[model samples]
Target: MEYIDLYLIHWPMTVKPGKYEFPFPKDEIEPFDMKSVWEAMEECLRLGLTKAIGVSNFSSKKLHALLSTAQIPPSVNQVEVNPLWQQRKLRELCVAKGIQICAWSPLGARGALWGSDGVMECAVLMEIAEAKGKTLAQICLRWVYEQGDVVLVKSFNEKRMMENLDILGWELSDEDNHKISQIPQCKGYQGLDFVSPSGLTNPSWSFGMVRFDSIIVERERLQRTVGLIEPIVDSAVIPSGIVISSIYLKYKKMGRIPEVLLISAAPDSKPMPMIGFGTATYPFGPSEAARSAVVRAVAAGYRHFDTAAVYGSETSLGEAVADAVESGLVGSRDELFITSKLWCSDAHSDRVIPALRKTLQNLQMEYIDLYLIHWPIIRNFALDREIPPAVNQVEVNPLWQQKKLREFCVEKGIKICAYSPLGAKGTVWGNDRVMECEVLKEIAQAKGKTLAQICLRWVHEQGDCVLVKSYNDQRMKENLEIFDWELSEEDKYKINQIPQQRSVPAEDFISDVGPFKSLMELWDGEI
Candidate 1:
């Protein structure tokens, strides 16, 4: 007990309470509730469970989210920080928040999971190490120490251990630091399997992929753009980038339901609602049904609409917007954000603008707020003039996490508006892999939220705009209700641990008779 000075949650995602397994099986993980869990940590502080409570592998955004509700913010964040994987964002955020930065994989985890060979093999680190008359590992540890970070280094050999402890004796030159910073960042260790959804039920196969800062990066994106959020009635969610706030203002208006949170693309772009209404449905569902749902969505305070030419519901969606304007549900078409996509057949370079124009014509709108290549794979590609797509529509959920694709989109500054976030559990081609997942069900039961709500909220929590579709008016309203509440850090964690599957795979097109060959050829083996 005396030796244990600090206790930490090693990873954010919590596996089932019993025992930990490498290829963690299905129904073995529980959703993580960050605030509630932190509160428990605070209780530990009261009981002297440990002198300090800390977290490992947390990013800036995750730390910020933790800080948002923590009674006692984390004392430290121990993470991988090396010459090869510099974690600059996490470092700066920790400094600003007065939480000490602790580097765990100081030498890039050469023999461990999530470690990259790049750190040991880096030309820049080798150059510095040779010049300084130190081991490359020593130089790596020294570099982290030079950055005012506490480095946790390990060595099993006596001589190597002495050298590991000797990092403080020497310094890395300023020129060397610059070169190290410019090493052309690529992740070394990827443990995305920790949060992947598909491996749970089927234990033999696992989702082995890279997870950079989904918890941190996505949260940082939201915080930088949307700012801090509070659930109290006094607080408003990202409205006009902070115009006014007063707890007493509720008296000025009574019984007012919260509206969709509005965020700007840039400082100049008009504010657009985050939760959008999806016009896509079961292939057999009628356009009129989608049209009616759009009306209900708008009346329920959704101002963003998503559709595609492939979905064949654009005209009805447009008519619904027109009807909403005429009936005073919305002041003008400008108040709503409309997004459409180019189906595969018309996804050709020359056909791109024409397809968008066709969609615009069908919707009776002059310009679309967003347009996307409905599918990223280009069976054929060249170039033609067209507006840049503001978003890319994809099927994202706990089961189909799409970690690599999501990270790439986040890196490229493209918004990922997820459709079918619940995995379309009841659809003909769809299965219960999503809604019936025990982790999701546990989260729903714990939070007192529906399975659909937990899934929708999971998508939103990942810091992407989400589109939800429902035929019934009540369900439409229910789908639109995601904005007012939130999922906890634990909820997000459990969702992350769900095994990944390729939802809505174009198997028909991926067969030997079709384009290229194999689903692996199509997805680059991400599935």
Candidate 2:
């Protein structure tokens, strides 16, 4: 009892009746009953495996059945109870029966299941957190506990776990609780009756049918994020497809609204056309020349703005973005798709937030639409040529590097934008191993696509906002034409045959003075 504050049976090991299938369907087994599991929990409590024992993810009917059979009733029942799917009745029953309710996925689980709608991102919650100087998670947990239930928040990270437990001292006002309770319940998880014949027979059962209702609700919640921009009313503008129009008309349509604009440079607004001018950023130094170039691009109707802190051009870019907004070129900041990169120096887990703050300050923006790791190096390394080899060599990409950064960004709702995607200019394409590998080229030839297009397409497939840089307009247009053609399985297999090799040499910059050894180390992980 002293060893554990609480013990929870995560999920029923047995699949639903129709859902159960054993090893290639040859060794099928019947579904096991939760009554047996509850019996086991009773034994554990008697033996002192926990001070309090409970069942997680149990339905109301399941709980009642368990109660009817158990010698000792469960102290708690853990289940998903976010704003979208409040599980109010279950919570009320647990309260009435003297059973504590622990919310398992209070913030929603995977995107496919939860669809992002919840009290987690509610304006009221955010306002409360801002007033109290706490996080939304902290506020949500406090709400859960205030209702006389133990909140079962989980995180693999030690820091996050510790943060989850730090919500005890703060209390919410009665008014706050009432407002939170008033939030309309929306369903995030559907197909709860998976055992029903119709559900079992559906093909979507294999992948789980995501509740689109919740997705629409979540989109409505975040609609304010893009609310500032006015909608374009032209009958010619379609929601999705290649946008073929003068840069001015495209800007006039998209700039007035809170929507994504798919721009291309083709005369005919046909599908799969080339993009004339892709988003560009002048990294490495601050130059008025670069600002002028951006101004020119904006004047030519480019809606996407890309910048970074390490490049020192964010200040100028910010000024340009502000000017663009003020000049009516873009109706609001939300109308523009702004992307920036987090430098290698700021890739440390602890440094992520502060680094983003600095970027925001420099850019004079509230939030960035997308942020990328400039390079993929895991440890601090130098870029000086004169440094001796003994002092220069440092660890580069540790498998966990990009994964940690990506998780942090994903949780925060910041899009991950991959830059120098093929590894800096020389490193990715220059390597003999990479160049000699005929698979990518073969795929390109087979699909009548450029080798660079194959690389960009592969990166795009990974769910990142891909940034491909080119000085030549033709190359830029060719790079932008990627969305038109889909690479076949054979093409992907041919490209996969090529072995991994660093295009930019890490040894050239392994001095341990900056965030990365070289550009190669920055892109060590595949997208």
Candidate 3:
């Protein structure tokens, strides 16, 4: 009885009719019999192997049959949970039977077997975690515990296991709990659906319907593009001409040193641009074109470089940075700013440091000048391109969530750079809204600036260095011209008035394939 907080019957006796294996046979053993499993569980309890015994992944039919023949009825039932796959019926059945329900996979598991949707990126969870100075995962786990059940979280990593245990002491507000419960449920598992006699079933799981076919098309396009670039370069590289040297020249003419070019605005570093290698470019990774562009940027006298751990091109970028320094293109690392973002998969405090260290090692640098959160939301989904509801919509980190990280970086004097300054072009406020937002347009009109200029200026005005990307030299120059004009108080106010909106809904894309949840989680507190 001492070995287990609860004993578990691992799965139902049979998988979908024709399937011989049970519960992921590639990893778990097959030829399982529920009757024998239940009897063994009973013996374990009688032999003091556990204080309680439970059945895991069991259906109502199986549990009913088991109870009909058992000398000692099961004391608990465990099932997958998280907003997607809420397992409501199983939970209710256990409740009615006085059998405790132990929730498993509270945070959703990695890879695609779990559905992909950004449900976990709930605004409520982010908000609460932000207020409490806790992680969204902690808040989520606590929510599960508050539901009056034993929560089982599995993490082979020592740090994660400890972090899981650390959740016992916190309490969630009723309002927060209510908000969590209200999170729209989305279906994540489709393997079972295929097993049904229906042969074909509509994947109507929530978080909005995903056109997996469309995503596949887009992903294929991206993969093709990546493949085209992969053979030409060894790592992620930024093209030189792509950077706005004209803007640097213009700023010099204005008697402004333009020491930093902030990428975007985030909660902590609000109203200030973040620090970085002057005006950044996007689609960071290995490419001859990108390398040529970076070389040109270096030749043209640009000195800063930015990349992230997950970009898979830091080595190339690092090589460029080092070459620039060695050739006296930049006097020293201090003279050249290098920035990278921590991936969301490494957002946990324990994981954060190691990830950063690995990134640094890969870049062949002692430390980075700036590190940022790629996005503010965490996508809860599997890492597959074919799956629907591809991202688990989870708010792994809320706005104002990087305070600790910010302080840490600042303490180390590492400047923070924020990406997706205007909430991502594809995300909140699409190109149309960005171009037509009454306030922004008015500001642009008043300042005689283009929409992109106004957007970049808004980020620049925030104080930290700002980074804006454009493959076209003219557009890059335009994005950098932001320093030439300042937003008026009214203009600033108007820009601020635009309601918060995310253009990239997690459901539309696959999750867990990249690091960090929405771009926000990657930023260390510097925002």
Candidate 4:
């Protein structure tokens, strides 16, 4: 071949140059020099021998070591992933680093000499397959697919290959995922076939072996000496996003669930919850904060999450979903709605798909429920493209009703989504007008509602989906209480009379040399 698309170091350790065989002599087994080997892989990419370079069977600890010194990081990490042996910790690291996970033994290598039928014989998987009218293998593949990992199944039979491909277009329910999570986890391959006794005991000899079972006790004893729990089994079973406290659950029970918007134009469109948790934090908080906040939101019964590439919260959102699924906070990521945007930097038609793929990677999800153009302008392309715009997300509140934009979207069969319903007070792009308005305060006081709730309920009453951001736990639950209430005619009249002024006027893009010269052009005079 002229060039290979992907080249990966199959295993971390280097054997003697003579013959390719397993269980080599102890002397022939040498420590895998990660830095030098990754550098060589980088050279392969530079010379066009391979389009991308990556690693296989790398542990989280080993990956951190390699990532520390490598000039070019691995693009993918091929590992063993099945419901029976879910590699949650390693997958978490891979997701965070933007490394694609290529599953090697998705079905536990069912028919191979070295493989087991554990995944195929999994009772939970068998039950799920039967209920879904699918084969056990299909259930396994679909589960891996749901995790947003690339499946590398080794199937030969034409009929079975067709069955494998049929795994798409259906999903495993939350109960199925929860049952699968409770299954006993055991590593199929313990690296015993490759490692010698000396390598097992010697600290420096087996840095390349990524399996947790073979090195956990020694590594933990040598590293920090914490014995609170079986680290591997504990982390593997409980998802990374699982909530330890009952605070979220308590708040969730207290809040009313938001109504959902059915977007018929979307592919396999799930109902987009009218009220969503906004992930863009002013002052740009840490990813941990985002992750924790999302978990809390999920616990508080918030289903829709609005994020963007520019927001830098996609990774945390993805992590939180994974944690929630694993922890049974939710049945699946499918239960929630995720909406992201096409940033202006990638607004062009050619870059749109790539930008979306990057967003999926950042979110650690296979598909986004709704994807929208973040801003009005595209670098070199018109806003009118082949893909029908399904939703128009804009700032909508008592202060800025956006009636013109809402009317236009209705005419075009597009859903109208409101953001900053409380005027995004305290943010640089927002104003205090909506929250501080006497008209809104009066309505809220009369109705025994919070000022923020009055604004959200008004937007909801207008039949617009609203996005509200609050990392605080109490406020997070309070945002969902709007669906149970309604605005009276007096309240509606007062809100309608409130002075209208757009809070976030795309001022950054309104420059002399840019596509938009004024707020009117930026918003097409809808402002």
Candidate 5:
């Protein structure tokens, strides 16, 4: 009982109906009785024989049948999963059912048993591994590790074992993640013995068929159980994956909003955690006050930190991240997703890389998780760079949602993170039109939520990410409560009925003598 905490139903097989396999006469083959077996497992849980029970090699079709009848729902499904396999069908089913997924041989075996090493030999995985200064093994492990699933790497050699353990302390970038997805999927381990015609398998669905119900369920079971993002590793507990919005967050328990609320550059790009820490404050530089606020956010489970060099919080954010890791609030620099923007002054192609380098130096990190163009000014027309921008941070709210620009960017496979999501209430540049709207106020009262949450949730529910700033801890926590619940159809219809207008009439860009003589010309009439 003490040695093993989790006992699994390895495969969907049991003793032949009239023949007992456990006390085998070394003659009879095992027959399938998955239902009765699972019931027995539940009884074990009731008797305290095991803390949890799950299954392995059971496809999504099998899982659904089990869930419908299970008295104690299985907590996890262990399987031989890898980048080569992709496991999209199983992953989707697992995400919806709140069952955690853990991988057995995450890296495909070739020399060990299988003739071909799909994962370790793949060009994309190799390329990513080289660029990230990690082993192919590490890349494969990290890929699944990032999937918010526990990866089991089998190696007795000290160096390779060390490499497996080194999965922590660093991470794979979205670029690497995209490349891995580009590799065509082929399962490395087809070691299922029960798939043959004579072997026992589910009668309702073919052994290979993996279909499930359309109903999707999402629960952050992995974060609460494994705590994989924390520094103190649990010896007995393994990591797991939860389906949130059909995207894998790679140990995204650090993601404050659970159930996979993320924004991606591409459908395949490593999805960016939804909420971001906005540093566009009254006094831009990372003062002690600004740094303290970020630190508090870090402690409160924020991984995406948004700052612009112009905001003057880069250095303070850098310092704060270093402090956060040293203080054990965060596990590593990679755990927090740092986003920095290029100010308009450095918008020229020649100045872009140097400006980004300067920002990286200020943040005191080897690489920034995401670097963006701060503005869409005329200078952007002439800008150039080797690395493309990941996101375009702009002012957007219900009043100025910029639906057209967002669609264009989505086609280009670039994400849009809305700043000033809430009407920047305290600033001269912002107005109270959104927060003070009568419709929004009525919706807030009806939902029993704050006006700020209503506004932030609107942007989140629109399938976009939002940046919000709150120095107040209580307020910051409130802003992040978007994913737990959702807006109703009536509330959404009321919001859509809201009148739209451009908040920032860029008069500064218009001059009688300049090219943009009117605000319409300045924004091409978007204003």
Candidate 6:
């Protein structure tokens, strides 16, 4: 073990150099210098001594300060959380910063010296455990897991460990979640031993425990700001988009448009939405922004969603859907259509099912509405499958309309779902060619529409489904407004005359040793 997987600061306080002991001298206590300490953590990451660095017991204020000066933001924040102490405020802050919460003492450390019996003895948890036929600890742990946070439970006994791991296969009902939400909140652990007399300031808390003074209060006063301590909108209260960047944003109920049957022959096929939201973003990684954006999209009436394993958005998309359901934005998961793709690397026969299963797991869904081979260059896909492919998703925009493939797919009863419909600006495979087209610009100006709206309208008018990606609240709603308007024949003619070019060529998939050897071979001269 040359390198550790994760390294975290145990506490956000410092003491004099000596053999470690509790109840340190007040004169020896010192404020934690976050900037210098985080710099060293960054150095540790750079030197490959640790895969990730983070902090434990960091309140929202401390985490905010560290993030402000951090070259590399904390990957995780280890915090104490349970039904008794949900830490919703702290959890929201961490989510917005893209910091994962690793819940310590998730069961409230019921038997430890610093633990409380509140979580273990709560009547709400007891009732849930009895009704569900599970242990109280299991019920507590499952609730934390459902919050999209990691749970840490220590059990040396074999049977107890097995019980802890068994929380995954099933879920708590919405009623159970509601009951737990009403439980009185109070933190279990109070680090009063570390609060020095000299540094002590505010001492009282809801639980009647002495809160650490300088660690929680002073640091908060110094670090808290309108931007840092500001809370994310509670979907239950707000149930819509919130103000962002000093702009009030409200996601309009774009309403459900007609769904197109993907496979006319398959009796079990679900209809795919004609205009879907794309969750693929450049600098691909899962973040709260992705989840929050998807939630807002759902509020704005987006039913069909496009995600892939490689895009790294499946988890966030899944979480967002769960949130939407919990918030009553949608009746259930079945009401929304979700489509995921098999990555090119997993195109082999042996890998396909496993990849799809992993995709389902990431999405936390039993089945996918539509699944497509992300690209054709991976391995040769046989057409003799038990289920025929329903859709062929590719790059399509005003500049590159993919006329040849579009006609071929429509003739074969397969729908064409267009990705990069606006040239996918700011990505390695994307360029500004489509957005900067003079012809589309003139048409957009004349019609009093944004350049993006013009491109999407053209794609929708072509009888092809469009996948539009946007994180902005106003833009997300604006993308869905293309259904009402109709593009004129002259506007269509001008768009058709634009020079055609593919935005995303499979150069990365091509290699001398791999299946695809060149661009021409990959696309079979389609480009």
Best candidate according to TM-score: 5
Each model's lDDT: 0.64, 0.51, 0.50, 0.71, 0.66, 0.73
Sliding window of 10 residues with minimal summed lDDT for model 4:
220-229
How many clashing residue pairs appear in each of the predictions shown? 14, 16, 80, 2, 7, 0
TM-score of each: 0.48, 0.37, 0.37, 0.51, 0.53, 0.51
Error of 3 at 87 (Å): 58
Q: lDDT by residue for model 6 over 59-157, one digit each (tens)?
A: 776677788789999999998989977877778788888999999998888788778676888777999999999999999999999999999989999
| TM-score of candidate 4 against the unseen true structure | 0.51
Alpha-carbon runs more than 4 Å astray in model 2: 1-283, 292-305, 323-329, 341-358, 370-417, 426-437, 508-527
471-516, model 5: which lDDT tens digit per residue? 9999987876775567888998888888898666657767789767
Candidate 4 regions exceeding 4 Å error are 1-258, 261-264, 377-387
Top lDDT: which candidate number? Answer: 6
Error of model 4, residue 481, in angstroms:
1.0
If candidate 1 were superposed on the true structure by all CA atoms, what would the RMSD be?
Answer: 19.6
What's the ranking of the predictions by lDDT, best on top?
6, 4, 5, 1, 2, 3
Worst 10 residues of 1 by lDDT: 247-256
Off by over 4 Å in 1: 1-272, 284-286, 378-389, 511-515
Model 2 per-residue lDDT at 473:
47
RMSD of each: 19.6, 21.2, 22.8, 16.7, 20.0, 21.1
Q: List runs of model 6 lying over 4 Å from the truth.
A: 1-256, 264-266, 377-388
TM-score of candidate 1 versus the correct structure, residues matched by position: 0.48
Q: Write the per-residue lDDT of candidate 4 for residues 1-527, one digit (tens) a residue.
A: 99999999988777677997765675576545677788999999999999999999777777888888888999999988888667766776788899999998889987675577767776668878899888998999999999999998767789998888887798888778766654535555545344432234345434433223222122211111111111111222223343232111111124234334343544234445677888998666437988999998876777788898888888989999998766655545666789888888997879999999999999889998887778763211123434445677888888888787666555555667888898889898898888789988888888899999998888876767889989898898688777545788888887788778888776787889987898777776766
